[model samples]
Target: MDSITFRSDTVLSDVHMYTPNIRHLMVRLNAVGQPVFVSKFRILRNINVCSKDDIGDLGNEENRELVGVNNASTSRVDCSNTMANEKKDEEKKETAATEILLDDDGDLDVPRRPSDFVNSCEKDLWREKVYPTIISKGEEVPFEEYDEDWSICNDIRIEHTMDTTLEDVGKQIWRGAFLLADYILNNTYLFRGSTVLELGAGTGLTSIVMATVAKTIFCTDVGEDLMNMCERNIIVNKHIYGAAGGEIKVRELDWLRDDLCTDTKNPYCWSEEEIAHLYDYTNVLLAADVFYDDDLTDAFFQTMYRILSNLKNRSITYLSVEKRLNFTLRKMDVTCDAYDHFRLCLADLESINDGKTKFIVEAIKLTFPQFLFYERVEQLELWKIIAEPLISNTQQ
Candidate 1:
């Protein structure tokens, strides 16, 4: 948006009259083409002067008069009088135009008033508020308009949560999620016909993308409100997944809750029984950004373990988590080392299974500038773990 600055005492007619102070007025332009004045002083005293015709150059005949003495004098008078009358006529037309422009559905085009200009500014700010921020390397990266039709991946489906309360904290989907989802989708053989489950599926962008290739997807999140929002986004973009013929089921899966295995209570939970239904047809499980809290990590892994072991055949779980370095440092004094804690926990679990559970952990380093359009944002590496169950001796 643009800002226009002028002196408060400046009269409407004074704009038509040549004044040095008002000659170099600054105007702020908005996205909607409205101009706003941002000076501490109240400029442009009369709103009536802010009409369509009055916005442009003032008619001055002295500059247009010729040089010859006799003709110049007479011409000057005639020109001055003519210009004066013309200015009056223009003013009348401007008044009529202003009236029409102010009408609810008027056809006349006119410059926006100061109030209208301010309203447009507020709207633009609101848009900025809702827009997501991409952060990498501890900095905020800029966002660009995404134009790719990512649903074309034959083996994967993607769903996006364009709106979220995280916007309240200025956190939104970054390019890291997009890149990972795109990579998995393009590698169709890895995900196609697989029964996939996405945790913390905010806006379900990744899940929707995966659903394109997955046979059946259980997109789960923690809250009912978020689940409903996710469902709405899926319905709005149903046409994108038309080619893949994948099914997307959005449900609430609270990580802290149990009893998901039974059909009677907590049916929304993801349990072995639910996994069994898809055992013959399912192959892989996926989750993104599901490791914000260490307390929840245990339950998250336990749930995955149960799901993996319950499958009749082999199944794999791919989890992507952006390590919060800040949280790690803060919690260091209160708990065991962050990285060691996770490793020891996994080791203990492996001991219980007698090494029957195989887990492979890899770190994917992502560049901040590559993932974000803004230079201020930082990038960090995301940790991905691929977990599978060891075959029994008899089966081997």
Candidate 2:
């Protein structure tokens, strides 16, 4: 599906195309086996393309190309059961919609469009919503083209189209969520019986997988609508991961504020009740693809620092991100600023380098158990953050 559309009026080169109409850039690549030469390439997400009213970018990038590119006969993600249930559900909705238009309120001979659906029950109301698609039903992360027989499988639910408001990002499960979830599944022992808190847990995909192994999971984001969607997915999939003998609870955590201090007196700060109920039990933190821009990067680290500093016992945070570089025709490559800011914040906490009795950030070299289930996007990396490691992090 060469649907990778571009703005008609933007500047174009032999290998690159600029679409100022959207925030993301697009590059036309050579064939799979050809050795193509280009000045540079970057995985820049065009945030404002589909979501006109929304701000901020998303992950996984609707790589519809990869989805349909895989041979249908040998694809790993089995969507048979998923499609059957959906077909039946759609049929029911279509039938009910047809009946609504034939009622005494209007003429019966005309075919009514969906917008013509009036007096619908709450369930049938056409609110701004997204339909679920069967992209990548959870399989073991594939190692090579031929790897098979994955031990664990997760069926994920995601939206086909979503609004781009800051809150709407929670509608779909991004690639970062899949990568982090794969890490948790591979490192299941570390999370056993531990309380895990997920920040920016869009759609609760990562939390859903973590819930399968951890004692408890607090799925948090910014808005009520997003939290409701997250909670709905958790509840809908309870039998699969929820039955892993853990519970998933949703909460609102706006990380943009400067109120991440330990002071309980300030109303803007985290409430004492929230700390006692949720944060107190948390010993591990999880975030994926949360580092997209500069402001978000600073606030995210501040939230992490506030929590690590307030805690009496040492805790560890696992952050997974893909460094997105923006390469332009002028040979100027712009990268996500969050990556640099995170490095600065982590370096300042190094005991030997900065001499601060604070949290330490280290890069863990983990190459085993490659999760080939989800599409491994460009330059994805995993970092480890610990408040106080029992052993010195020589890797740092």
Once superposed on the true structure, which residue ranges of model 2 sit more than 4 Å away at CA? 1-154, 159-167, 258-274, 328-331, 334-336, 349-357, 370-372, 389-396
Q: Where does model 1 exceed 4 Å of error?
A: 1-176, 261-275, 327-352, 364-379, 382-386, 391-396
Q: Summarize candidate 1's per-residue lDDT along 315-359 as a digit string, tens digits.
A: 665555443343346656444344445555556555564455566
Displacement of the residue 302 alpha carbon in candidate 2, Å:
0.6
Instruction: Indicate the residue-level lDDT of 286 in model 2.
Output: 93
Whole-model lDDT values for every prediction:
0.43, 0.50
For every model shown, what is its TM-score relative to the native structure? 0.49, 0.55
Clashing pairs in 2: 24-46, 54-164, 141-371, 141-372, 141-373, 142-372, 142-373
Tell me how far the alpha carbon of residue 202 in candidate 1 is from the true structure, in angstroms, after superposition: 2.2
For model 2, the run of ten residues with the poorest summed lDDT: 34-43
Q: After superposition, how far is residue 231 of candidate 1 from its true place, in Å?
A: 1.0
